[model samples]
Target: MKAVLGPFVPSYTGPWLAGVDEVGRGPLAGDVVAAAVILAPDRPIEGLNDSKQLTEKRRELLFEEIQGSAAAWCIARASVAEIDRLNILQASLLAMTRAVQGLARAPEHVLVDGNRLPQWEYSAEAVVKGDSRHPAISAASILAKVARDREMVAFDEQYPGYGFAGHKGYPTKTHLAALEKLGVTPIHRTSYAPVRERIEQIELF
Candidate 1:
C-alpha cells in the first residue's frame, strides 16, 4: 500500500510534514485521542499500516518504535463531555489541533487521515486512508490507538463492570449487556444512540 501510495513521491514537498490521526471515534465512552507525528523525511519506518489492521502487540511495538523514530510527536484528547458539548466531529478536530500544537517543532505541512481537515493555521491535505499510506499518519494512528486503549483499560479498573479493557469502549454486546445491568456510568457517552436509548428505556420503567 505504501508503494502504491508513493510515500517517497513527496506529496507536500515540505521538509517537515506532520501526519495526524484520531482513535476512539466510534466508542461509547472514553475520550477521543489524536496524535500528530513528524518523521525525519529520510528515515522512514518500514511495515507501517493502519493501526486497526495490526494486533495489539504489533501496535504497541510500532508505537514504541515511532516514539523513537519521529522528529516530534504528541497526543491529545477531547473528553467525552466535550464530545457531547461540541459534537464528535468538532471535538475530534479540536483534539487534532491540540496534538499538533503540542508538538515541539512546528510542522510545515499537515497530512490528516480522513476527509476533513481542522481549521488550523498550517497547510494540510486530507487523505481518506492516510494512515495506511503515509508513514507519519500510520505512526500517529498507532500512538492514538495505544493511548486510548490504555485509557480504556484504566477505566475498566475504575469502573469494574463494563469490560472496558476487553472492548475498549466499543459498543459490543458485552458492553450493551453491562449497560443494561449497571445503568450509565460517568464514563458512558450519553449522546451516543445505544446509551441514550438505554437511558430512556430505564427512565420509562
Candidate 2:
C-alpha cells in the first residue's frame, strides 16, 4: 500500500513549516493531547499516514523515528479540568496552540489537520484530512496519538477496571460499563455527558 501511495508531499515546502494535530477529543476521559512537528527537508522518514490508518506497531515505530528525524517536535495537552472548562473543541485548539508554541524552533507556517485553526500569532492553514495528505501533519498525528495512548495506559494502571489502556478513554461499551460499576475518576472530563450523568447518579445516591 505504501509503495502505491508513495511519499507524502507537503502543502508548503518552506524549511520551517510545522504540521499540527490533536488527539482525544471524543474520549470521555483524559487530556486532549496535541503535537507539532517541523520536518527537516533533508531528513525524511517513511510510512507517514493518518495515525488512525496505521497499526499500533507501525505508529510506535514511526513515533520514535519522527522524534529522531524531525527538525523540531513538541507534544502538549489540555487537562481534563481545562477540557471541562473550555469545551472539547476549544481545548483541542488550545492544546494544538501550546504544542506549536512549545516547539524548540518557531514555525514559519503551520498546517493543521482539521478545518479550524487555533487563535495564534503564527501563519497557518487548516487542511481537512491533512494528516493523510501532508507529511508533517502525519508525523504530528502519530506523535499525538502515541503520547496520549501511553498516558491512557498509565492511567489504566493507576485507576484500574476502567479499561483505559484498551479503550483509551473512549466511551466504549466496556468503558461505559466500567463507569457504571466503578464510577468516574479524577481524569474523567466531568463535562462529558456520560461522566456528568454518572456524577449526577452518584449525587442522587
Candidate 3:
C-alpha cells in the first residue's frame, strides 16, 4: 500500500528520512530491540503497516521485502542488563540510537514511532503512532518486532518453561506463574516489580 504519509512524514524526493521504532520494552526478559529503516524512493512495498496490526505471516513477508528493497536498514538492541541499569525508556532510546548509528548510510532526518525522541545529534521528530503514519517507521517496527520475537524463541530454547516463545517474556499470567515456580532467570529483569517480588519471595522462603 502507498504510505499513509502525513504532516510529520516527509514526502521529499530524497529517501534520507530514517524511521526508527523499538520493541520488547515491556518484556520481563531479554533485550529491547530497535530498527531504523530508510526506504527507497523508487521502491514501494505494498501492505506496509504497523507490525502490531499485521499478522505474523504478513510481517514475515514484508520483513523480507523490506530487506531487499529498503535503501538502508539496521537492527540493534539493549540487553536485559542495560534495561535493568537504564530503565526501559532510556534503554529503548539507546537501542534506537544504536540502530540509527548502525545504518549503512546516515539519514538527513529521523522519524521515530513514539512521543519522545532519543537524545541524538540527528535532526529528529517523535510522532505519535508513526508506524501507521509513515512507511519507513512501519518497516522499522516490523523489523524490530520480528527480530525480538525471534530472539525470544531462541531464549525459550535456553530457558524453557517461562514460555518466552509464546508470551515473548511479557508479564502474562503464565509467565508470572512460571516466575513464581521457577524463580527469576538471569534474563529476567529484576528491576521489574513482578520479577523482583518473585526474587524476594524466593529469598524469604
Q: Please list the C-alpha lDDT of all candidates, in the order they appear.
A: 0.90, 0.94, 0.91
- Identify the superior model by lDDT, candidate 2 or candidate 3: 2
The worst-scoring run of ten residues by lDDT in candidate 3 lies at 4-13
Q: Write the per-residue lDDT of candidate 1 for residues 11-107, one digit (tens) a residue.
A: 6767689989999889999999999999977777877889999999999998898889889999999999999899899999999999999999999
Backbone N/Cα/C clashes per model: 0, 0, 2
TM-score of each: 0.93, 0.95, 0.94
Query: In lDDT terms, how accurate is model 2?
Result: 0.94
Candidate 3 clashes between residue pairs 3 or more apart in a chain or in different chains: 1-46, 1-47
* Candidate 3 vs. true structure, TM-score: 0.94
Q: Candidate 2, after superposition: displacement of residue 33 in Å?
A: 0.1
Residue 150 lDDT, candidate 2, scale 0-100:
99
Comparing 1 and 2 by lDDT, which wins?
A: 2
Better of 2 and 3 by TM-score: 2
Relative to the true structure, candidate 1 reaches a TM of 0.93
**lDDT score, residue 153, model 1?**
94
Model 1 CA lDDT for position 175: 96
